[model samples]
Target: MDPKVITYYFADDGRIPNHPSLPLILYPGALKEKSDRIESIFNENNWRNSWTNGVFDYHHYHSNAHEVLGVQSGSATLQAGGEQGTALSVQAGDVIVLPAGTGHKRLNASPDFKVVGAYPNGMNYNLRRGEIGERPQALEEIGKVPLPETDPVYGTEGPLIELWKHKERD
Candidate 1:
């Protein structure tokens, strides 16, 4: 069955410098079985350099590449976009794809909460804390960051490719 997808667009909130066009993608219960092999699945789709860990309590974002995080176990409430963004509750088997420059932070999680994260094309990632004097560069890099050729969860054609239409940025 095709996975159900939910999309969210975050504005440039000054501090976070969220992506202007791409909406964050969510796939609830997308990896119901074999959640333990999320990293392998991601790598298979060309989203590489996988890592397993818990989300940071403090808000942070990547400016160099898009990110995909799959819930390996347990559950958590993750704050997305920025301080003004929404609080999303995710659980095991859920997948979240964040475009470059989107802010995210962990509000709370279960004791065993763990997630597997990967980047498109094994792109090198850079961490940003929505600090002062970071918006200009972050925005620039975000615009130049290319879209992934395949969805981390679905491969060549999926909700990601359909929803993330490339747009020209100023």
Candidate 2:
């Protein structure tokens, strides 16, 4: 058996390049956690500033971009394939890493759930909107993998609540 290989490269101040997703999920403010350097293998490299809030929301992964969500406070579940796909539970100080081409969403189990993540190779979060537009089959509703759950968290029928707006602050 071989051990996983790990390499370390330091960027002064530590930050990664930004890979913006098309059609933009959440809002600018919600995604405004910001970065400083690019980790040879991570997203939003430095974790000094953070993107957080008290709300229930969902997101999908980019075509070739995976994500790492580490819970620093409260807890939540990463639900894939609608309501019965894969349910990964997480609590304070726990880490959940989703590989590239994986699609999933989060359920805010607490009034205030916060997480810090590190993504290597910056973010291509997903292929361009044009790319998805090219593939109607892939773009046809995420969560069809049918995550296995009867009434998992964030699994209900109702109006999606509003959280943040797409406004920028200077």
Candidate 3:
């Protein structure tokens, strides 16, 4: 199925300096009743190094690699793009793709809210809480992150590849 991609451009918000090339992608209900199918898809698409857990409650971003979060069990309200960002209500079978430097936090969740997260090429990730001192290095790292060869949910021809590559050209 196709995903509904959402793009967010955040300025140097004095805290989190989000990415320029990639946008946040939301594939709502893309895995409905098939939450367990995510691991295999991610692995097959080269999005390896998977883990299952709940999202963090406090706002944070990854500076090393992009992340894909598949909602495996329950529902939650997630705040993306830092403290002043938008709030999103996500449920089971939904997937959220966050580019490097995009801030995210779990505002609240149902008791069973579980997610499977993975990185492309099994890339190791770094945690940054938008501290003032971390901005310079984080921004540099964000710019250096390579684009994923394939979309986590959809394959090579998905919106992620098209949009992200388009953004790079512009």
Candidate 4:
């Protein structure tokens, strides 16, 4: 009596059951769960400004996303895969389980980091949408990459992104 020994429990997005590009879709009710004009929930998304100099620019990977970051104020460092500089100093609630290829970065940015993210996917966008053969050699190495220090919180006159360059001739 062994019908191929059936035993199924497919849910290891990150660990136990919470990884599919950070998925755990649920919304019930509890401590002030008021719905109306605001509910973008990716831990109340608003932490834009990520980088990687040398024209490398956001190298990606994710076989089944599961990004969970919860830091209620300042502190970030998440560089995965390459491990050239080594980063992973997450703070606050600190509930990590970032599986998949694990290549993320949001390092050293704190005017109060403030985070709360929960992802649990099984529908789509565990993104790896390819079509980039390093467009023109990564825009000729991001036009000879530069800018490592000058970060007075954007006052450093940094991000003016527009690689893929080659503009000469009057």
Q: Model 3 TM-score?
A: 0.94
In candidate 1, which residue ranges exceed 4 Å CA deviation? Answer: 166-170
Task: Write candidate 1's Cα lDDT for 54-74 as tens digits.
Answer: 999988999999999999999
Q: After superposition, how far is residue 51 of candidate 1 from its true place, in Å?
A: 0.4
Best by TM-score: 1
lDDT of 4 by residue, 123-169 (tens): 12233312255233322332332312221112123121111012221
| Candidate no. 4 TM-score | 0.23
| Window of ten residues with lowest summed lDDT in model 1 | 161-170
**156 Cα displacement, candidate 1 (Å):** 0.3
TM-score of each: 0.96, 0.42, 0.94, 0.23
- What lDDT would each prediction earn against the true structure? 0.92, 0.33, 0.86, 0.31
The lowest-lDDT stretch of 10 consecutive residues in candidate 4 is 1-10
Q: Give the count of colliding residue pairs in each prediction.
A: 0, 24, 0, 14
lDDT of 3: 0.86
Candidate 2 per-residue lDDT, tens place, 45-132, comes to 3211223342235544433433445555676775532233456565654444443334456764775677654333333334323233
Residue 124, model 4: lDDT of 22
Question: What is the Å distance of residue 169 in model 4 from its true position?
Answer: 37
Ranking by TM-score: 1, 3, 2, 4
